[model samples]
Target: MKFTEEHEWLRPEDDVIVVGITQHAATQLGDIVFVELPEVGTEVTKDDEVVVIESVKAASDILAPLDGEIVEINEALPDNPALVNEDPQGEAWFFKIRPSEPQQMDEYMDEAGYLALIS
Candidate 1:
């Protein structure tokens, strides 16, 4: 999966969605401190405001990757914000959503494309 200029990534599986910050975003965020995720069953639209990530420098809003119903939230972030900084591409992910609009994925940049922009 790639990312958006806003620093969100979308991994759309068969019936689930995985959302996370890109490595580029993690680098920019610095030391993560806290996270605010929407509750399960919340209805969200494409690019909706859904999460709040606090870093040593400031807090950033984590936008929804697609229009979907929030199926699950990563409750783990409240205590281990460092995970976002330590491994943004792995376990540090924000949540899993059942995407309602898969076509929005086309709006995001591919890994290579996003890397170029950040580079």
Candidate 2:
């Protein structure tokens, strides 16, 4: 997985890439209450606001870390938003995309780099 400065994370899964906010972002957001994801067929560019996560503190956009076409979304979010806080990097993932430029994944930060960035 890779992380973006905007706090979004990307994990490769076969031909698609899973995307979500980092654990740090979930912590900063407080308790997540709702999530808004783009439609399955939507096309997005790097840094595009593809998802919106609403927390007790505030609502924040979860940007796309790479250009891609949305292929799927976590249907469980609306009914169970806290999953974002409970497992931001796991079952809480927001969406999946078929990347337009897979190489862009390497341009983002690694786990250690992301940790240093937050620190």
Candidate 3:
């Protein structure tokens, strides 16, 4: 798993990459109430605003960490947004993307670095 400065996490799974916000991000958001996910098959570039999350505190955008095609989104989020707060790095993952440039993942930090960043 790799983590971005924006608090997004990416886990390579088979041929795709699973993407989601870190536990730190979910805690900061403060009780997510809504989620707007990108449609599957949509093309995205690095830093593109792909998912919108609304919480009691504020609404935030989840950016694409790499150029890729959004192959699947977690359909459960729209109905149960609180899942983000419940299991941010697990079942609450936002989407799976097929990266056009898989090597771009190397630019992200490891778990230790991410922990240091949050600390």
Candidate 1's displacement at residue 10, Å, is 1.3
Residue pairs with clashing backbones, model 3: none
User: For residues 16-118, what per-residue lDDT tens digits would candidate 3 score against the true structure?
Assistant: 9999999999999899999999999999999999999999888899999999999999999999999999999999999999999999999999999999999
**What is the C-alpha local distance difference test score of each model?**
0.85, 0.89, 0.98
Candidate closer to the true structure by lDDT (higher is better), 1 or 2: 2
RMSD of each: 1.2, 0.9, 0.4
lDDT tens readout by residue for model 2, 16-107: 99988888988999999988889989999988888888898888887787898999999999789999999999999999999999999879
Q: What is the TM-score (0 to 1) of candidate 2? A: 0.95
- What's the candidate order when arranged by decreasing TM-score? 3, 2, 1
lDDT per residue, candidate 1, 1-119, as tens digits?
A: 75788877777667887899988889988899989889999999976889999998998898887888998878888889899988888888788888777777787898888888888
Q: Model 3 Cα displacement at 26 (Å)?
A: 0.5
Q: Which structure among the candidates has the greatest lDDT?
A: 3
Q: Which runs in model 3 stand beyond 4 Å of their true positions?
A: none
Compute each candidate's TM-score over C-alphas: 0.93, 0.95, 0.99
Query: Model 1 misses residue 29 by how many Å?
Result: 1.2
lDDT of 2 at 26: 88
Candidate 2 Cα misplacement greater than 4 A, ranges: none
Ten-residue segment with the worst summed lDDT in candidate 1? 8-17
Q: Give model 3's TM-score versus the native structure.
A: 0.99
